[model samples]
Target chain A: MVILFPSKPSILACGAVAGPVERKSVFYSFFDSVIEDERWGQKTNEQGHSQMIQEACDILMKKAEINNLDVDFFLSGDLVNQMTPTNFAARELAISFIGLFSACATSISSVIIASLLTELGASELAIAGASSQHNAIERQFRYPIDYGAQKPATSQWTVTAAGYALVGKHNPEYPSIIAGTVGKVVDYGEVSPFHMGGAMAPAAYDTITSHLKKRHQKITDYDLIMTGDLGKIGLKILKAMFAQSGAKQEELDVLRDAGAEFYGDDKAFQAGASGAGCSASVFFSYIEQQLKIGRYKKVLLVATGALLSPMSFQQGETIPCTAHAIEITME
Target chain B: MDPQEYQQLEQQMTPPTPYLKNVLKAFFVGGIICTIGQAITYLYVIFFNFTEQTAGNATVATMVFIAMILTGLGLYRKLGQFAGAGSAVPVTGFGNAVISAAIEGRTEGFVLGVGSNMFKLAGSVILFGVASAFFVALIKLILVSVGVLEW
Candidate 1:
């Protein structure tokens, strides 16, 4: 389902910068939600996206000036209530229209919407962005803890920061999200919400495999086959599922679930994160790295967003996941 | 960035036991967490004469309260020493993190201290919570528009 953003908008130029918090705060510049405190420290009232939207606008404005956009559609949101921070930030930016979305895969969501609009000739350019904060995050999910708790090794801490990737015509500097296959949630009827990463892993594999199936290719075809935010369990489970579907073990490099890994076990379990921005932050960081190193060629950056609610959790219903794979190529 | 502190945290993260041991611990603890959740639900129904839905809310609240208490008493550490993800993955664990932050923040000052620092480890949790809700709403909007869902 295409949201409000345009298709394949030409990214005139893109830039990323972080505030003075810490090196890790750089992550907030990408994803909408991130806890300010590493699992080892104290907390804050700042929503993860709050910090991100601020910096994202600074970057977006500077980039917009350079890219020639006085006013444009602002499609942005985080895993926060009503997208309050994002909307507030959008108001400050004075954009034409704002579309809020909760696909934890905001990075890809932004890209997909922008790309589709750009390709459809709806608009020449647009911007997609997100950020996360662990402080606000921790408060929302669980009550406020003022001290240390016994956390397991699998637990991962959410990172903080916001990042924005500009969309315009294909340039060597900025990239475009090309031919993508939308993912559908297929409930084998066994996956659970608590085990969201695990549940979505198969859907990711299914989408990737289906994309490959259409092109008559396999996991071996791409330099890297990225899944949105399947953390340790999901990653492990996905590999097993892929193998079950006949994908070889040593096939491709997958960069996923990065934010929590940065914070480590002081805050998370299952060695991963649960939210929208998990994949967004990692993919943003990785995309920049890939572009810089020229290590990316035909990279399938598939972003995933979990579709679950309190109602679903209450009903003992499983999480329904959706993924969209956009091919980023060097050609 | 203190080397010793980093070392301590690093050590804390490393498992003292093998995966099998960890898995067994996680299974029991996780099962206990789930049972506690169910128990709370049951308690809500039996004592308060609540429905399954209201009881489920009680279960979540109970779990959060227990985790918060454990985080304060510093007793959850013992549980984590034994169980792994079992104690980590649930809402109880998220509760532990926020309460832990508030506890740590209390020593800092007051207004800007504990109150501001209350949600430390949970920033992303809230961020994504809101972001995901927006995404969910959008999806619901699209689904309803296309007749995929009635919401």
Candidate 2:
């Protein structure tokens, strides 16, 4: 079921921070802070993940003209195991914290939970954010930084970035979060590690169809229906799934994957960017820009995540996945 | 879906991997690595007065040591990216795999980090190697007893 916000919370401010690599991407203009140092001047890549979160949160607070004490809660997550980086960052920030894990779909997941909290009168102001580092994720999930192992063409490079959105009472100047749809874990018993797009496409399709059905809306109702980190292959699979379900070609045209959008024509990114930061960076930056400029009135940001562990993949278990969609409309 | 049905869906949904290109890269890189090993063996034989057989063993050891150093310096990942399976299927690749895990666990401190995690990736390779060797030796023993083979 789609959770409709009666008190529609406005995204007053957002902060998008990325590593030096993103500066090479087209979305460079959308970021508020781009640290050239991959380590963020930290001793390790794991430490850098926490530093990015803290910086992103600080930037969001500064943009919203609010202090740490003024915020009611901080909802954040990262791709790191146990989400220790987010936990450490919260320790430094000392705000009421809720650590979430939806793999790459975390940005929208956190936003949905935060917005729900605010709409239900549980929080006055809540911040939702996520961060991921290329090196840190590679080391933890696959091989170490030194393995020098070859990556398949379908392997998505993790985007080293963090994104934050501040949700509170509706404001005329900001885009309002009108609704959110929580996703179910859909696993078609896909076990391929390199083919994340295929593994996650089913869940994206499931969530998108459910959200549209619940709201009695057609695909044409939204200007853009974006999925988080489905990459190139995943997008094709999602479209095919929709087509088989009798969705028109024109209707499927609005579907765009955030990972594909950010790394367009960048051969170095193989498939695309995959991580919690993928949606966080793209939404808080590119999508937010289009909304602010009135280019798109209604947008469905569906963040997808492949809930797989290296141990599980090695143990012959299929990858389970989930996708969460948030409806943003500018009045 | 059942495993068989899911497998069919995966086959239909997944795109075809460029196997030819990967094979070419691996072949080229693997050849280069073997050529380097040969060169090291000759050097040991010619300059150190060692026999070819002993030099060959030393060459393997040297390559593994160098691979470990490259892993620590974070240069092996780049090689792996370019060479694909070529960098991974060799003895040196095994060294890189073990050292990489050890280094990754370094931040958590010695016992829990480096010591425990050093074999995360390479431990299986070692297990398989020993198991296969045992099987091969058992076969050799059976052949000798049956008078079908001579040592």
Each candidate's lDDT (Cα)? 0.59, 0.88
TM-score of each: 0.62, 0.95
Per residue, candidate 2 scores C-alpha lDDT tens digits across B36-148 of 99999999999999899889789989999989888877788888998988999888998888889888888889899999999988999999999999999999999999999
Model 1 chain A: which ten-residue window has the lowest total lDDT? Answer: A1-10
For every prediction, compared with the true complex, DockQ reads 0.11, 0.57
Candidate 1, residues A178-228, lDDT tens digits: the string is 566767764444324444554566567667778777766667667777776
Q: State residue A289's C-alpha deviation in candidate 2, in Å.
A: 2.1
Model 1 lDDT per residue over B1-151, tens place: 2334423433443344477877887888899889878888888888889998878777888888988778778677567656767887788877876777667566457777668876766777989999999999999999999998995
| Clashing pairs for predicted structure model 2, backbone only | A148-B76, A148-B77, A148-B80
lDDT of each residue in A1-331, candidate 2, tens digit only:
6899978898888999999888776788889999989889998788998999999999999998998999999998998889988999999988999999999999999999999998889888999978899889988788777877777767788899999999898887889999999999998877778888878988998899999999999999999999999888778778877877788988999999888767777887888888899889889978888899999999999999999999999899989999999999998
Q: Which candidate comes out best when scored by DockQ?
A: 2
